[model samples]
Target: MSAPISDISGEHKVYLRFLGKARHFLFNLRSFNLTPAEPIPAAATKAVEVSVALGCAVNGTAQPSDIAAAVKMASQADVALVFVGVDQAIGAEGHDRSHIGLPGVQSDLIKAVLAANPRTVLVISSNAPVAINWEQENVPAIVGGIFAGQEQGHAIADVLFGDYNPAGKITTTWYASVDDLPHFHDYDVRKGRTYMYYQGKPLYPFGHGLSYTTFEYANLEVTASALKPQKAVGIALSITNTGRIAGDEIVQFYVHVNGSKVQRPIKQLVDFARVHLEPGETKTVSFALGHDDQALKYWDEAQQDFVQEPGKIDILVGASSADIRLKGAVNLMV
Candidate 1:
């Protein structure tokens, strides 16, 4: 194919400009070319092609006939997979969404399809989180297909099947509705912005995800019951995969100050370790807390600089904040 007709900037001026943009954008990791891709390796011998039907549009009027056709296609299939979510047009950078539902009649389409086939998987492919309360209640599975570029479909398919044991956790809190979220203008995370500060029950709390396999925690140990300003304290815990498949577990460490004079988050994540374990395999993960890790400092109004306050803090470890399993306390000695 021929290139776009340019006013003699050069024969390949457009290509040169593209290369320059690619060089700079590669550093930010926000953009990539998916037109060129390496051939995907062989799939499972039993793998078969699945049909996807999209009759919902964000800007157009809802068509009953389109929904009827999709339902007919779904009724014959073993399972239905719906890829519905906000896109660049609805949710984008330097812009704010007016509402947080599935963008438009996409939610309506989801309901219609569910009426025909309850064995539906709602795959959300958006940059921002949207309400999925209805689907979560009725659908068999919900896949968070965050804008994963060109190979997005392949990645989604891999997870939908048993080929990939996804252990990735959500980074932010997912609410049941827009009403559950804080005011859009409130930029302060302390004002119920994230899992660390949010007060209400979230649809899916931060750091929440399920693996194909299961892991059990045991033998939690803390090296010291007291903390010195310059001394180091260690915390160790054992994790075992008690399921049939192998997977990775992110061991999160959070600390809650028992008594504090200044405002603080409910619990702050100080450290984390990602450990991969096979079936029935066990591994001990450990983390250390030194001056930088345990030294809690807050901006002092009376004083000009940040000041450290000595207090007792509880060490909590688990897969997620809502799943804390082990607990230990250490008195901070200044």
Candidate 2:
């Protein structure tokens, strides 16, 4: 590499500098030696390789093809795992994406492969959400590998082979399409941003994930029916693993103000807990939230401060924001 990589400076310069630093670090770690660039060695020898062919060029220009060879291969295979996603070139910290669909004809390739192989798994590796409404409806299974980094292959392999039970949930709302969103420059989240304010149904809501096993929520309890200012209350619930295998369940807690003078979010996440359970085993999870909890406070533009208004606060507990299973309420005294 040489100096003066770019005439630009500041953040863009910092983003560019990482390339040089990463090159050096990777070389030092013996991962690569690009100085005298040699063909990288294959990680495995026993793995069979197939060339189904991509449906597009690197520049995202679609090139539709017969894809007979790929379809034939998929039809004969026991199961087909179609990997598709965007790269840093398509999405990064410095810029915004133009659209959310699978780049070029990747979606087309997926559809063809899926038609031939019903036992198909759609594995997506991306930094952000992708619009795959068709895949969601038709694909047998889908795995979201959001920028899992270097060891992602091993992680995915373990989960696919049943050696690991994935319980990780999506952190953000995955909208069904780009049309479901407000303008990019709209800084006001109230206009429809995030799980808190978005009104439409999403492809996948926040905190959505499926475990290898199933669990049941029960015995929800709220310690206080009324709360004083700067005071806290305890919330508890019981969860039982009712399936054949052991797995983890993430219990989410959310709140909604029954009646407020000003506009408020539909629902807001307050706290969460994760528990591991064996088949037929049960565990109790609990959380604490004070009247002054930051999550319960709303910004007051006139006062230039955050405040918790006096009202009925509805408590919701469940697997995800959209999967509430228990309900309770408490009054915040004026």
Candidate 3:
């Protein structure tokens, strides 16, 4: 057995439950039949803490021997799963981290593992976005788990083994580096914050995720080209599963105010729909953009109320904010 299993029954209740509801499975890391030439240190094994709540206290540089042993194990294994993350010390309430890089020698660990095994999957568990540009360029697959609960082990295992196809997309724009961001004290979102106003090329754009299957987007139609500020419109599109396997696709609808008097988001997500499709199956996704929707209106500081600007509004639909597949325009009449 790779790990010991604990039975939870009436009288056999275990109290050392720091990681709540976490069940150790039998077919774990050891079950993969990895044989390292040298023994890996406890510090090396502690680097892969799947839970962000478990504070990563392992500090300073990684020992050469530990790294060498890990490399040996990775080279022998078919695939290596490198888990790295930040903890409460690095990311928590009221504590602002100066940079977004991985804490300690976690980056070193990832780079070493990737060098040893090209077929390495980088798994990150953190409270916020991390700049893993090197890994993004080299690592074949990356799984971001933002404090995924106690059952994250089973969930991650399922995805790794092809038992599950991940369709959930990241809600935040992952910057390429900390240098791309404005000062944390700059509360004004327009000063390069969030996906709405971020100007730099994101490492991973908002609503970015990959599935086992591929999807094709087409047939974008808007109900009205011109409408009054108070009127609503229906936006519809067809999405087809073009791959062999079944999966879920999130159709995102975005809008931008062209030539507005005041500042506006480059492109703002207005509506989204998640649909499951079998192989070769096609589905129609529709979004009702009404007058009251926040995306249709911008905060008018002078007027002290959210107001719809009278001008051309560009409509974009696709997988993500950066990967817009369909484009259409509308006019908001004065």
Candidate 4:
């Protein structure tokens, strides 16, 4: 017998061991004085092995339309996890897009699959937001995976297996259509552009995400009755998960100035926190707001840096921009 080896990495060792077995079988066949049939090609052999390992029957290569058929098959399976999102088309390097709908019948595929499988879970993978056409009530769960790095696949598998609870929230709005966005292209110009400048409605407002569990926020408190220029203020709230499963909650804080020399968006996200909680667990989450968040950066003829002006600032706390659970007001005395 050949010398046994244990120093190889797991994946490397698996292939090495397969090669060893194949060689042994071929050697034994030679001793029978009979030639063996043509051996299978390594690439083809690997493909078959991988398919078997994944418990997936090779249904041929997946085309854009095949996604729908796959979903139909998944609907019949025990569980369905659909990974849907825009890839390089709208992510990275691209500053703007001509249209904002699902590309190449992807949405149509999702709709067909979701119709057939109401219990499916949608894991949205995108660098930016997307408009999902399917009925929201039909999907059992939805998770946003925002360019989640190298370990994305592992992280997703872990979440689906209940090994990791999703705790992330939306950083930007998911608008119903491109038209809803303010100036679609120029919103971020020198003077105007941002969620605060936008006029129309978004499909899903910023800082919005659903967890496996539920969380309730209460007891809103602020460190200072009034904010002053060049000073920091603390805002705290208690969050308790009322659901059965353990999960993470993202608490968002928005600021709205009653009146200002310069115009402002309807609301702006100033601070946020992601807190983990077990069932019936409660924790205090807090964040500090400084001159940067409260003040508008304007060119000053005398003073160089951006300055804060006296104004009424509204502090709204909630799960999302559209869902403010609590509200507190403070006047900044410049």
For every model shown, what is its TM-score relative to the native structure? 0.83, 0.83, 0.82, 0.73
Give the alpha carbon lDDT tens digit for every residue of 217-271 in model 1: 9998989888887887899999999999999999988888767776677888888
Q: Write the per-residue lDDT of candidate 2 for residues 1-334, one digit (tens) a residue.
A: 2243335322221111113234212112223221332334586456445345544542255534545556677888888888777766676666568998888777877888899989998888776789999999999899878867656767897888788888888999999999899988888888888999999999999999999999899998999989887688999999999999889999999999867877788889998888999999999999987878876778899999987788899899999889999999888875
> What ranges in model 4 sit over 4 Å off?
1-72, 89-91, 94-96, 135-137, 183-185, 188-193, 291-305
For residue 244, model 1's alpha carbon misses the true position, in angstroms, by: 1.0
Clash numbers, per candidate? 0, 0, 0, 2
User: Candidate 1: worst 10 consecutive residues by lDDT?
Assistant: 9-18
Give the clashing pairs for model 4. 187-193, 196-265
CA lDDT, every model vs. true structure: 0.75, 0.79, 0.78, 0.66
Ranking by lDDT: 2, 3, 1, 4
Query: In model 4, what is the error at residue 174, expressed in angstroms?
Result: 1.3
Candidate 3 lDDT over 218-263, as tens digits, reads 9999999886656888999999999999999999999998998778
Native-referenced Cα lDDT, model 1:
0.75
List, residue by residue over 215-240, the lDDT tens digit for candidate 4: 89999998887887678789999999
Q: What is the lDDT of residue 85 in candidate 4?
A: 63
Give the worst 10-residue stretch by lDDT in candidate 3.
Answer: 25-34
Candidate 1 backbone collisions, by pair: none
User: What lDDT is reached at residue 171 by model 4?
Assistant: 73
Off by over 4 Å in 3: 1-61
